[model samples]
Target: MVERVVATEEAIQLINKLKSIHGPLMFHQSGGCCDGSSPMCYQEGELKVGASDVLLGHIGGSPFYIAADQYAYWKHTQLIIDVVNGRGGMFSLEGPEGKRFLTRSRVFTEEERKELQL
Candidate 1:
């Protein structure tokens, strides 16, 4: 099955580290005006999710979500979560770790899209 979201090795390492220190984690794709499309990391359930948030999939065993409205703009692409040097959103757990989660994407191919029923 096609995964709508996945993490890179660097990201997985960081996620594991964060999990060790913070326990389970989750990711929410930030909509614009601040962090842009930055992936904000938080302890699992730190931020409540509901019908308005779409579960894109998981990365490094962490559930990833995007606002239902934002999903409409990203439904056709795969979200690649990566790690880089920088501070993330103030509210994200990773902000204090000197590293931030980044969201990169590529439009799904016809076959990939079909596999995902997109």
Candidate 2:
């Protein structure tokens, strides 16, 4: 099956590093504002997800989600999580690691859409 969210090699490496320090982790796409669309990483259970959140998929064994309202606007695209040199969300695990998680995306191809039954 095609993945709705995936990570780049560099991102996977960073994720492993963070996991080594923080244990397990999760990610949430910030809607905007302070963090803009940056992906926020948290140790599992550090952040609580509720009915307003939608799990897009997993990257590096970590579940990734987006606010339901944001999902509505992004449902047609697949999320590609990557790591870049910069600061991350203030509370994200990667913030102090000198790297930030970024979101790159592409419109789903017809075949993928069919597989996803979108």
The 10 consecutive residues of candidate 2 with the worst lDDT sum are 29-38
The lDDT, on a scale of 0 to 1, for candidate 2 is 0.90
lDDT of 2 by residue, 12-74 (tens): 999999999999999998588888568999999898898899999999999998998888888
- For residues 35-65, write the lDDT of model 1, one tens digit per residue: 7568888899998888788989999999999
Whole-structure CA lDDT of model 1: 0.89
Write down the TM-score for model 2: 0.95
Candidate 1 stretches with Cα past 4 Å from truth are: none
| TM per candidate | 0.95, 0.95
- Model number with the top lDDT: 2
lDDT of 2 at 93: 92
Q: What lDDT score is found at residue 59 in candidate 2?
A: 92
